[model samples]
Target: MRQHEAVINVMEEHGGYATLGFLNQEVLKVKDCVWKTKTPFASIRRIVQDERFFFKIKPGLWALKSYKEKLPTDILPTKEISKSQKEEFNHTYYQGLLVEIGNLKKFQTFVPNQDKNRLYLGKKLSDITTISDIYKFSYDHIVRMTQTIDVTWFNERNMLASLFEIEHSTPMYNSLLKFIELQDFYTDFRIVADDARKKEFQSKLSLEAFKPIIKRVGFWSYNAVAELHSKTSELISIESKLRL
Candidate 1:
């Protein structure tokens, strides 16, 4: 029986015990290991392909027999998200639809307190060119415009077309405050949130603090936004066809 030359070489270099750890250490020391063996290349390939064996030969190095012992249990598992994460995801989803609506209306959309560097809803709405002079728009003015509003669309005349606040899982009080601040302006004010929260919205609106502006504000569900988006798209398509 002829022994593989590579195995013989490893034994000769390491003396007696060519343990897996010892072989790995020797392989690390040498830049490359030239195997002088009668073993067929096909046989070598088969052995290397086996998951049980960790044999890798690269341009400048060769590692043979590096096996990690399997643990009894999984080291990593899927994790459950926190309430804040769910709320954030919901907020992003509703804000994305508002961004689409602004685009369809051909109005400049602004997301106050948004990081322009962060990419959301295809492209950041803050990065898009707006009709409002950003340099001239004061911080206080932007705060008043966006306070708790998730999205605001303005025409070229710098007049507000629509104001939107996505309540998601958040309390409606802050959004209502923003609506009250800008209610004097003639524009559509909408609170977009989950349909399940309709009663919660009504309850908040019934409060004495919110009574004065309750009639001015409107509520929209996620489904409502989707329907409006679809209708707006259809309208734009029809207008384009008429132009042709």
Candidate 2:
């Protein structure tokens, strides 16, 4: 079997579409296809760009061209759906990526209660999150505020390590102001949104009110977040084999 053929087979088994991280993890297991290169992951990345056989669904996500029409509605929302519904799916998809990435990095993950029921791929966000309640590492008021964050990663000490807010179509101000509330903490903040909105994010972060966190906060485009997620999994897989 060919390399791209193996990737296609794996994607087909996954119902037509799969994340770059998923392909990197599963494509290597195909016994018939021998990946002789030192950078098989890179090869997979290049293969997905063939375009003749696959199509990109989103950042870090691709689907077999043959099965595009058969993918789940959530994976490829149609024009018949409301704009809000499409936005909702995109938001949760990134949240799911963050949750999985945090878990792989040995951090406890969380999402707001209202998002707990949203589907990330086929699984519920609540089902995949590591914690049901935010750690009461601070005052009641502070903890309550943290619970409403889009996605949060808590370190082993139960301290906030990072907070990510997906700004698909929402204002960056809301997420930035929310981050401001937790500015005292030694945590990193990111506004995850489209590359087109990067200027908007920077402009919002420049406001006098956000100056306190200007150094601690950064803008992450959707593609960047997706790339981090896919690469993180690759590194973990390497670590497993390199452990002494």
Candidate 3:
């Protein structure tokens, strides 16, 4: 098979649509296609932008031009849906990406109780996540605060590896406050939001109130997270192939 044909075939298998992240994970697995370059991932990125074969639906998501009108409503919501509906889809979509990334990295992931029942792609967020309950790594009050974080990655020791809050439409400040409670622990504090909101995030993080944990806090734009998830999955896939 031709190289672009491999990507197209994968998208077709996925109902004519696939996230760039999803492509990174699956496209290279096609045995009939050969990736002769040192940067197959970069090649895949370039191929998805070809426009002749695929069209971008949103950040990190692409679909075959042939299935544009046939896509499921939830995959590509119509204008008739409320703004909040679109926000929820985006929110859970990123959450699902994070959970899958953490799982591939061999970490236990968790989502808030309120979000447990929410859909991430076609599966419930809770079902995809490794743990149903948050680890009791700290005091009751602290655990209470941490449990509500949008998504968390816990190390094998059951301590927090990272804490991510998807601030889709919410204030980044509130998420920062939650990070404050765990300053003593070595944890990666991330605010996942739109790249456009990066300035707003920087402005809030500059406040003196957040100074103590300021150095540890970081911002991850939605696109950044999506790309990271893609690259991580690609790396893992390569390693697994080597074992074969």
lDDT digits (tens) for residues 1-244 of candidate 2: 9999999999988888899988888898898999899998999999999999999988998999998778788899988989999999999999999999999899999999999999888889999999988899899998998888899999999999999988988888998988999999999999989999999988999999999999999888889989999999798767766872
Error of 2 at 87 (Å): 0.6
* All candidates in order of lDDT, best leading: 2, 3, 1
> What would the per-residue lDDT of candidate 3 be over residues 1-244, giving only the tens digit for each residue?
9989999999999899887878887898899999899998899999999989999877778889999888876678888888998899889889998999999899999999999988765679999899999999989999999998999999999999999999987888899999987899988999999998999999999999999987898899988988888888788878887873
Residue 73 in candidate 1, Cα distance off native in Å: 26
TM-score of each: 0.58, 0.96, 0.92
Candidate 2 residue 17 Cα shift, in angstroms, is 1.0
Model 1 residue 241 CA deviation (Å) reads 2.1
Task: Give me the runs in candidate 3 sitting further than 4 Å from their true place.
Answer: none
- How far does residue 154 in candidate 2 sit from its true spot (Å)? 0.3
Q: In candidate 1, where is summed lDDT lowest over 10 consecutive residues? A: 69-78
- lDDT string for model 1 (128-209, tens) is 5353333233357755556336777877776777888887767888888777776667778888887899999999888888
Candidate with the greatest lDDT versus the true structure? 2
Model 3 TM: 0.92
Worst 10 residues of 2 by lDDT: 235-244
- Overlapping backbone residue pairs in candidate 2 total 0
- lDDT at position 13, candidate 3: 91
Model 2 pairs in collision: none
Reference-based lDDT, each prediction = 0.56, 0.91, 0.89
CA lDDT, candidate 1, residue 42: 30
